[model samples]
Target: MTATAVNTTAVDLEQPLQDVESCLNLLGEALHRRDSAAIELHAASLHLALAQAIEQFTAAARNGTVPASLRTRLMQAGGRVAAQRESLARATAALDRAIDVLMPGEPTGLYGASGKNERKSAFGGSIQA
Candidate 1:
């Protein structure tokens, strides 16, 4: 390959990888602050950057194994993404537990009251609405 092709390939890999890293940094900050708006924005950015990186990496792989240094960076980024996912899963589970504590397994709505649901007589009143 020509020097220009090599340089272009390097640029393609480097920029997307850097964008992914940058987006992750911003996302981490937003998460730390618990800022919903910032989180949403950064999450979208991260998604785009990660997608671009995946495209570039996939193309590179089709041609040949990605160069080692870039592969290491990609692996590290993937690890960070996994760690973030695990943390979110834990948080989601805790939120679910809290909801359960606040509102147990009891039925909701007016019809679900214990004694009220039992029919006194078939003709006395038609509760069907």
Candidate 2:
């Protein structure tokens, strides 16, 4: 039986991570413009794109099509993006908490206690306390 060859070369994950960063920067610009709708709309698409890029990089590395430097870069980029993602998530959570504290009663609000409707919508519980 003939054995199949496996490519062990790593892909450069940095380029895609850089792309992600650029996308994020664009998103920031959109936010700076107070384009809430635009930011919200693009955020998901940007996230998906970054994820796909990472996936492609990893796959290329596994397939041995990626060069050593590219592979290292890909790994590094993945780590960087992971860190950035965590930071963003934490910051977002903090911001939400702050908003919750500040607003305390808006269902459709971003930072607040969340209206009864939101509680119900998310947790299926009434906010009658």
Model 2: which ten-residue window has the lowest total lDDT?
1-10
Give lDDT: candidate 2, residue 34. 59
Top-scoring candidate (lDDT): 1
lDDT of 2 by residue, 2-99 (tens): 12222322224555656766766676676557576877766776688678776877676555555556556546655755764676588789999999
Task: Provide the global lDDT of candidate 1 against the true structure.
Answer: 0.84
**Tens-digit lDDT track for model 1 on 54-85?**
99999977865566788899999999989877
Q: Residue 24: error of model 2 in Å?
A: 4.9
What RMSD does each model have against the real structure?
A: 4.7, 10.0
**Model 2 misplaced regions, further than 4 Å:** 1-21, 24-42, 105-129
C-alpha displacement of 38 in model 2, angstroms? 5.6
